[model samples]
Target: MRPAAWLTWGALAFFMLNLAALVGAVLVNSFSTRWFGTWWPEGFTAAWYAEAWREYDLFDVLLVTLQVSLAVVVISVLIGVPTAYALARRNFPGKKLLSLLFLLPILMPPMTYGIPLATVLYKFHLAGSTAGVIVANLVPAVPFVVLTMTPFIEQIDTKIEAAARMCGARTSAVFLRVLAPLLVPGILAASILVLVRTVGMFELTFLTAGPDSQTLVVSLFYSVSAAGIRAQQTVDAMAVIYTASMLVLLVIALRFVNPTQLVTRLKDPAQ
Candidate 1:
């Protein structure tokens, strides 16, 4: 191989090693009793997990996270799929500009729009609640759904819908019976991606959520930075739990959705 190729591979390997080491350290520390100056902790214990579960009120936090994620997924799918159908079936003036407008929310950083969005929610007395967090998350999620589903809808033949119409099918029936069955793969992919994004989203949720509305990620942030004396192990344990939850969700999602196929559909809409 060329020297540059060797150098590139060497750098990639070094980056992977560092990432693995950092994750490994956190995983180990989550279970460690103490390690002031040693290669490893003198002992291991699972008590930190319990302490974190209690101190962090992880059950409630996780419940809120689940609720927020699920609500975003359902609402985004309902709103975005129909909007995508319209764009797919119709050619209208300013369609290109409208699509670009949809793309902006997904392309821009959450913090960029989150402040204004939060301001709007607060003005309407919706901020600092579960509904507010859901609405904030939906801004990016719905657009993501539209973009992901648009290609899938485009790949579908219009003749199928025409045929359904010929069979005396109403517009609603055409969508429910004909288009929906074929769009399952796209819907599942978009839903899972949205769910993951909601779980990880911090800025929007943080800006909109109250004490009772806080999700797992927000609670984790507070555990790390909020003023108080807390055990490092407890915080590490919470991190582990967060990581494990995401991994488990991904694993389950992958069981049904082929990520490579999803990416291919997103990248090559004509396909």
Candidate 2:
């Protein structure tokens, strides 16, 4: 093997090692009966796993997480798909500005936008409610949906749409029956990205959701910082479960849309 390739492989090995270390810490903490820094827990137990779920209503929190994530996915797709099609298919005045406007939220730090969004939701009596959280979360998600889907839409040929239109297909029909299925890979990729973002979003949820409206991420945050040590360990156990679920979702999503294509193109670096 070439020296450069060997170096690259070594770097990848180091990265995987660090990742393993971080994950190992989480697992140990989650399963540790009393890991008080005496060089590993004197004994490990499944007590934390049972305690976390049985005591804290883990399934309820997961329900909230799934509901919010699904809502965000549906609403974002409905709004974003058409806009992505327009952006990919047409040109108009202020197009650049309009595109930038959609992208600004993702570019700006969360704190910058959250304050104003909170105030708006409060005025509308939506704060701390599911609607409030969903809308606030949409600020970033819609832009991401557009960005991720636009490239796939662009990859499609305009001639196909033109033919459909000539064959007595309405614009909506062309979109529904013609362009929609073709964009499945893009939609799948976009859905997974947005769902992950929604599941992990805390800043917007913290500002917008109330006690019952709080997301799993917010619950985890409070569990870690506000609750004491046992609660912390229990939270780690819950996090372990959540991480496993995320991995499952990724695996399921990748089965439909290749993540390598969804993420970045793998290339020969030396080329």
Candidate 3:
């Protein structure tokens, strides 16, 4: 193998080693009873997980996270898929500019726009609420759906639509019968990505969510950052829970959508 290839493998190994160590440390700490200047804790226990769940009201937070994620996924798909179809098929003037605008949210840091977005939501009395959290997440999520689905839409032959039209099918029927089935993979891919993104989204959720609307990630942030004499083990337990949830979600999503292939197609739609 080439020296460059060896270096790339070495770097990836080093990164993964560190990542595993960090996550392992957190996992151990979450289950640890006590540790001071030792490689291992004095005892192992599951008490911290129970404590964190009860103390943080994790059930409600997880429910809120689920609600916000599903809402964002559904809304983003409903709005984005059609917009993606239009962008994929049309050749209007300013189309490039419009596409660029959609890319901005995904490319830019959420903090840059989240504050103003929260402010606007506040004016409409949507901020600090579950609906506000959904809307704030949608700002970036809809664009992501648009970008992910656009490539899928572009890959389909226009002649398929024409054939359906020639068969006396209405536009809606053509879309439902022809395009929708073909676009299933793209829709699933986009929805799963958006759902994951929304669940893990912190800045926008933090900026917009209220007590009742805080998602798991935002709630975790508060638990870590809040001033108190909270147990470190409990916090670690919370982190572990959040990590486990994400892993489960990814596993379920990947069962239906191959992320590697999805990304490859997005990068080179002509394939």
Candidate 4:
């Protein structure tokens, strides 16, 4: 191999090694009983997992996580799909500017808008509630669904919809029978992306979540810092569970969605 190529490969390997070592250490520590000043634990135990689940009230946390994630997905999709269809099919003035506006939320860091958005939610008495979390998450999620579904809608031939209309199909009938079936793959992909994003979203969720409305990610943060002399293993166990949940969602997402295609769509929306 060329010298530069060898150096690139070496750098990649080093980064992968560090990442693997970090995850491996966490996994081991989560299962270990005792490991003070030791290379490994004196004993291994699964009890910490149970303890973390009960002490953290993770069952309720997971439930909240699911409820919030699903709500965000449903709402984002409903609001996004029609908007995407309009943007994809119509040629209105300032369309590019509107598209760029949609891109802004995704392009900017959540922290940039999260504070102001949270303030607005709180002003409306929605903050520290499940509705607030959903609304906060929806800020970015709706745009994401728009960007994701836009390409899918565009790739679809408009002639098909026209032909359906030519068959005397009503607007709702064409959308429900023809467009929706054709859009299934795109809808599924967008929904899965929204699901994963909402599940793992920390900044917005953290800013808006309350005691009863906490998602798994918010609850995990509390487990780390909520004024306690808690067992490290228990915290590690919770982290493991959080990691596992994200990984499962990612795996399911990858099964149906092509990352390369999504990236291409994002980079070249005109296509």
Best candidate, lDDT: 4
Q: For residues 140-225, could you state the per-residue lDDT of candidate 2 as single tens digits?
A: 99988887777778889999999999999997899889998898878877888899888888899889988777778887777777
Candidate 1, which segments miss by more than 4 Å at Cα?
Answer: 1-5, 256-264, 268-271
Which has the better TM-score: candidate 1, or candidate 2?
1
Residue 61 of model 3, lDDT score: 96
Which stretches of candidate 4 lie above 4 Å from their native place? 268-271
Better of 1 and 4 by lDDT: 4
What lDDT does each candidate get? 0.92, 0.83, 0.91, 0.92
Against the true structure, what is every candidate's RMSD?
A: 2.3, 3.7, 2.5, 1.7
Candidate rank order under TM-score: 4, 1, 3, 2
Per-residue alpha-carbon lDDT of model 1 for 113-218, expressed as tens digits? 9999999999999999999999999999999999888877998999998999999999899978998899997898889989988999999999999999999999
* Candidate 2 accuracy as lDDT: 0.83
Off by over 4 Å in 3: 1-8, 264-271
lDDT of 4 at 235: 89
lDDT of 3 by residue, 10-99 (tens): 999999999999999999989999977899899999999999999999999999999999999999999999999999999999998898
Q: How would you encode candidate 4's per-residue C-alpha lDDT over 46-160 as one tens digit per residue?
A: 9999999999899999999999999999999999999999999999999989998998899889998999999999999999999999999999999999999987898899899
Those runs of model 2 whose alpha carbons end farther than 4 Å from true positions after fitting are: 1-8, 229-231, 263-271
lDDT-better candidate, 1 vs 2: 1
Clashing pairs in 2: none
